[model samples]
Target: MTGTRTQVVVVGGGQAGLAAGYHLRRLGVDFVILDAQSTPGGAWQHGWDTLHLFSPAPYSSLPGRPMPHQPGQVYPDAAHVVAYLSDYEKRYELPVQRPVLVQGIHRDGPLLQVRTDSGTWSAHAVISATGTWWRPFVPAVPGRRLFEGRHLHTVTYRAPADFAGQRVIVVGGGNSGAQIAADLTGHADVTWATARPPRFLADDIDGRALFDTATARRRALDNGQADTAGVAALGDIVAVPPVRAARDAGLLNAVPMFTRLTAPGPQWPDGSITRTDAVIWCTGFRPALAHLAPLHLRDRHGRIATTGTRALDEPRLHLLGYGDWTGPASATLIGVGRPAREAAREIKAILGPGHRPQG
Candidate 1:
């Protein structure tokens, strides 16, 4: 295998990886970002056509560059985000290798070996920023396989046109479910299903507010003070314009999660059946950590215990941008910078003064 060496090897060049690259560059650390995607924009490139941020452009930016504002757009759409990420990658000149599928990370003496389809990278530290977009989580509902109609997850959902004039069921109570259900309101006979009544945040609350709240909560906990409720106190769903409009039109109403799926549709608790033509699951995603399986870091709960972003069992391995476990709101574009900065600093400290960027 072709081999290369670096002081740090960052896995997954999404928002998190790019943020890490920025900080590492600022620290003069020799590192390369490995992205599985063929081009820039990371997971944003794969998002639904109409997907929009809950925040404005400024609040949705990466570490070094602000997302260029879209005229007349209060909440920028997915295309806007993709463009911003692509531009950010170029603007900072981050050392990112694309189309590099990382297969695993194994220990090699004092270094970690990042095995990728392209080649192997030996690094003193490895930052796994592989986000959750690839690992969409679909809850196992009884008789789901027996359903005859089209079934898809949030990852595969593109637009309402595909489900036009069909009876559709959207499952999950989060932002994806709300946005998707709202998108399908006029086009499809849609039923929004959730385990409980969906909670909507105040119209004023957006990504900025959510990040600030999470930061405050993290600070309070760190100082041994009373834990603040954080974003949960506000609500689950952010009432973005489309969702708000749908809610106002009385089309975004959600039903209780069905107990099981029948051939034609779902069976609710009261035995009421909805004859649905398709089911779109917006259930959310798990962290994409398959590459780290060789390290055996995950616990029984499928979580890697960490103090900040560094793995508790393997100090050389740092996990970034997974979610709250890595850092408060670290999964978001604006929120990833803090943890990335910290992780880069820690890696720099570990590498010490002897290691310098290779030419």
Candidate 2:
């Protein structure tokens, strides 16, 4: 209930935080993972029931363990991922404390102070792995408030049953949009709105391929070289069964986003109106960096400029698993392990070998 001191304190106990814990444990540092969620599995636990990873078992796993699945099983669903993350937590015995809502973080002389709703923690360094899931971002469009239909972001979306018998518009061109649209097409009259054409990898493509491709592109871009590899981005839709089925059934069509929302529905650029019942926004999220605002590392938006997951200006803080800006493919279950390892080593180098907890 009072301030708990440690050498290192990791905020956000999702995949990125868990991955960082894996490395910090190996580094033999005294640390604790402060999780906002009461349960394990991080943000993955909140995805829709039918949501799935684009990669096979091995590719979707963390650094220490391969995701378990029956022989020949490729993509895993939300439940399996959650179970694996829960089991991974128990298997490693990571020092995790749940339901610890971090309210603010600021530098206190040589140490960083973490103030939480329940208590406080002082650490030599802090790692902010708070992924973007909690901060769903829906872009501002004219007349958005005029729509009388139901509006929901993917964060609250759980299943397709709630949307039955309605004309729905699934907005955004990424995997969530694709999957959610696919799930609803069978039950509702669905229209898809995307800023750009949704690109799909070949049926055989998976997360591993996407990560490799993204890494290649990043490396090339950093070196000022052209991207020779014709690889798609990680955000590009993977043709999962439901999405593929939707594609085959001619229901995966996407139109450019409408100019604005109307009383009845969407108003297109040509002034055409489409009557709609509900809108499910899969537009994505911004980083959850409100707690770090006291640090003065973020910009006008809640975005912190980072040097390979480390704050570009702050020496004692590192961010992980929000997106590529943190590290290559850092947002994925597979991609987070590398950044976690590197960030832990960076902290170890800065804070010395073993740290004794101080109150």
Best by lDDT: 1
Candidate 1 residues 173-234, lDDT tens each?
Answer: 99999999999988999999999999999999999999999999999999999977889888
How many steric overlaps are in each model, in order? 0, 0
Question: What C-alpha lDDT does candidate 2 achieve relative to the native structure?
Answer: 0.88
| Model 1, residue 8: C-alpha shift (Å) | 0.5
Q: Please give the TM-score that candidate 1 achieves against the real structure.
A: 0.98
TM accuracy, model 2: 0.95
lDDT of 2 by residue, 1-359 (tens): 67778989999998999999999999888899999999998988888878888888888889898989835456888888889999998999999998999999988999899999899899988999999999999999889999999899999888888888999999999889999999998789999999999988788777888888878877888899986653553347889888999998898999999999999999987999999999899999988888998999867765788888789878889999988888888999999999999999999998775557766
Q: Estimate each model's TM-score.
A: 0.98, 0.95
Worst 10 residues of 2 by lDDT: 227-236
Model 1 ranges off by over 4 Å: 357-359
Instruction: Give the CA lDDT, 0 to 100, for residue 356 in model 2.
Output: 74
